[model samples]
Target chain A: MTSNLRFVFYPGCLVLQRMPQYELATKRLLAALGIGLQDMPQASCCGAPVVESFSDEWVYLAAYNLALAERLGLDVLTVCGSCTNSLKRARLALRDPEVREDVNRRLAALGLSVEGRAEVKHLLQVLMEHRAALKESVTAPLRLKVALTYPCQVFRPGDVAAFDDPLQPQSMHELVALTGAEIVETGVEHECCGSTLYTSNQPLALSAGRRKLEASRGADVLVDSCGNCHWLLERMQRAIWAGEPHKRLPVLFMPQLLGLALGLAPDELGVNSRVVALLGRDAHD
Target chain B: MIENCTHCGLCREVCPAEKLGGRTITSLLSGGDEYSAWLCCCCQLCQEVCPEGVDIHQVMMCERRREPAPDPHRRSFENVLRYGYAFPITEDINAMRSAHGLDPVELISAEQVRLLLHCL
Candidate 1:
């Protein structure tokens, strides 16, 4: 397959499994717009977050994934912002003559070494830049108003992979607008919704997620391009209701939200999950 | 010898460890009291983003190393962290990954879940 027609898509673990709807929706939307997503079959975790925290030894694993992409001769497209940040940081660090020499020495032990630069685009960045291309085929208009959220890792200072203002990014707003919807600015636009903390500290994650959900309670649907943010808010909304009929809120992944507006059926695009359930009937379905 | 009062809170505005309404970095550095500086996350983003480019995480870590981490619920949290079974494992079978030799199934930690995020 030629790289020109299809981008090498990297749907990091969360989007692939926990929220398969994201991948399904994204595939449908991209297909409608004549864009092909060549899933990077060999891609793996950018070594997760702790890989960056606990040891540089784990950094090599992510580096291996990056080098694999390099061999393919196309820049990688990562769905998770944290994965993008980690890969970008590793690439940046290894580019430094001193850092490269040091890291390469360790990598040599495993028979792997990353070469020069490669573009690591977040899913939002891809959508933002290509909105013009994708906007032409807007078949259905979205009526649901959305609250846009940009989590912390999407644009951290260390990796510096920001395409817009890291403090108050607008990619989500812009993309949602493509669906002909009003976008509201929530206070915790880039705040950590405590996704990683969810497994370790459910209380902490729920507390933080509640704060965000409460803030976006006004919107028709809370739209997040980040999987971590979407999952956290959705889970918290479930906890808040807990066997109650009124247990619901407007939480959705960016891809599914777009799919709804595009008039795709829920089953055709896999948007029938709880997230879209909050937005009322599958407008796309 | 008091290092002359060349009073410039430039050290305060530029330091990463000092919170928005917290103590100045110079005071912490000079007074040998590090508790005030131990809160830095050490990402060094603050220092690079700062105009003065102060190495605040380093300073904060230096002070933090001097004392024990102040975790009030350390004992309770330690139990949760050590067991890696903070959440109650579900009794009902929904979805699980099991090999030949395994100790039942349960959602363990963020680390394991994280792997599937990309792999899946």
Candidate 2:
């Protein structure tokens, strides 16, 4: 229950761009839980999923961020699953002598080196690890029913990126339960949100998202661990599947819901102003 | 030796791209279909469901790496290389941060990030 643990925060690209709300909520909630987060002033993208395979630069980019974290002398905490996965994968890959030599040679020009000592944990892991503290901090128990969705990175390849049970992650469910919200159901919990599919096939990505949204129709809110899934499930559904008569559900990133239970206001959590407005409308209904 | 594949199509059952392609994953992968490759989504679900333990996601990555055409994500990558972020930290974003009593977003110089990328 030690809340004094400090981690270097890596928000990754998607949060900074499309979902500052998640960042805002996370910062506030973590502060409330007495966990300290330090910022990396010069970190870049986490070499997000699809982009990594597109070029060799992706691995190096991921390595650069890892080396940056290593220099700070703190374990890294990432808000985005893609960032968590990329950094973790880079850390594992750098264990190879050749890969380390190659990456270090490149980093040498920038006067940085990958020590590979820094561990990367998703914010979900950090929160769940402190579950006792989180439960004690809940001042206002959430009364709504929620369905949880984890980013694909947290549960894949089983051996390397093993953040949880790949096929059936339990940490997210446990984390949500701490807020006193009921996990209404469990089907479609591990389905891909189709964020990466957008680049190649927008319709397929939308379809994948549509499937999840349709499946979660009975829940009052859809909960997500990463910003990309938030965007894919909520934003892309609006943009690409506008004509579809899918049930509309409020999607809350992990921190936002936790912040609510911690006594933070809707505005303080930076729940998308639009979502806030929608919630207002829901209250009247 | 284990059969390469029983053609069970279990991988296809879980594949988002294969479903979208309306074709076998082997056909979509071996035929060098760029659209199908792009649609793979890197979720690695196909790899998880394959009875033969075929790493179709890795196959997709290898094909994507060898693809001669410029990446659809090139512009965003360039933005990251140039700005140290893929999207702009606009006035509205800063306003939102400050509204929550949060400090403005920070970026290391794009030149600093670009230097590391260039070194690669």
Candidate 3:
């Protein structure tokens, strides 16, 4: 996509703290491509599904986040799926005259306000929109086959945040294609990786992950657009390998993979971390 | 919805919460498995990540909340207020924070907490 200066980048909770590489790579990648990701000085959690479960009022907490983006005078680009869905849904919901009034009043009490002005765009859309820039930026075309494992949270259902067909997602694949890496189109690509549940139920996490890996058949690696999927798959693989036939399919944040394709070194992009090892030590793997 | 469960348990295989508890969702749904709910971290990872799309976290949380309050975990903040301290103690949060030059910056006061609870 033709992007230039001035865009507010919403680094969801996972990206800001746990997955620093995602923020690092996104900031650099966007900068290299003439996209400016302005940070909100007073940003907090968007309050994902868990908080949303408790109360509809929790949604204003998210609207508060979008309001921060709106105050910045830029469209908000989020890298997390649930964050993307939550922000987009909150934006649409807050526009209701009644909800907007309620949200703004509650937030104003907290030094926040929901104006419902920021547009929500996921990183996937921006990357795909500027395919030509990404293509020209590739220092080395990665030739390994990688599965695009988009967990359900990352893919929004019809209506809010529904930019493409969630059932059969091809945006990440299309973006990967520009890097010259072979994309393994797998059915389980849309399956949930059990995300953070691995911390609670190890065996089920491993089983779910093994099912996904089994579906991939012979893919060289898996590229994830969400941090939770990347962490869950890698953690589950460890759980699975503890007893049975070890499956070591590597999972990567698509941004990290792009960094590698753009001639970034291993340690430079945090590829030396354990998860990156699953994708293999070399470009050919 | 409590007494209406089909004894045929699809929730066991499909539930991440049940898997962690080593029990079936059928049992949890039947007002049992309080121990598992006590162990729940409130991650909601189970509900959102379910292949079958069952709301396991809600089922577990409901079961947990009904029981006489259990010590799930946490020290400071409201986790201590509700769950008590169950999990192992790491270093004190303030110590680690100060070490990182990121000492705790309290946004709301204890009175605010009381006001919120009282308002509720």
Candidate number with greatest lDDT: 2
Measured against the true chain A, the candidates' chain A TM-scores are 0.87, 0.91, 0.88
Candidate 1 has which clashing residue pairs, if any? A12-B117, A13-B116, A13-B117, A13-B118, A14-B117, A264-A284, A265-A285, A266-A285
Model 3 misplacement above 4 A: A1-3, A199-201, A244-246, A273-285, B1-120
Query: For model 3, how does the per-residue alpha-carbon lDDT over B1-120 read when each residue is reduced to its tens digit?
Result: 334444445544444445544453345644454345443433334443344555554465465445433221112113212211112222343354344333232222333223222222
Candidate 1: C-alpha RMSD to true structure equals 8.1
**TM-score, cand. 3:** 0.71
Each model's DockQ score: 0.08, 0.52, 0.11
Q: State each model's CA lDDT, in order.
A: 0.56, 0.73, 0.59
Superior candidate under DockQ, 1 versus 2: 2
TM-score of chain B, candidates 1 onward in order: 0.37, 0.64, 0.50
Q: Please give, for residues B1-120, the per-residue lDDT of candidate 1 as tens digits.
A: 123323344444443234323343345544534334323322234434444545443454445435443352232223223322212223221243122111222323344323322222
- How does residue A256 of candidate 3 score in lDDT? 74
Ranking by TM-score: 2, 3, 1
> After superposing candidate 2, which stretches have Cα over 4 Å from the reference?
A1-5, A240-246, A272-285, B1-8, B20-35, B49-55, B68-71, B88-96
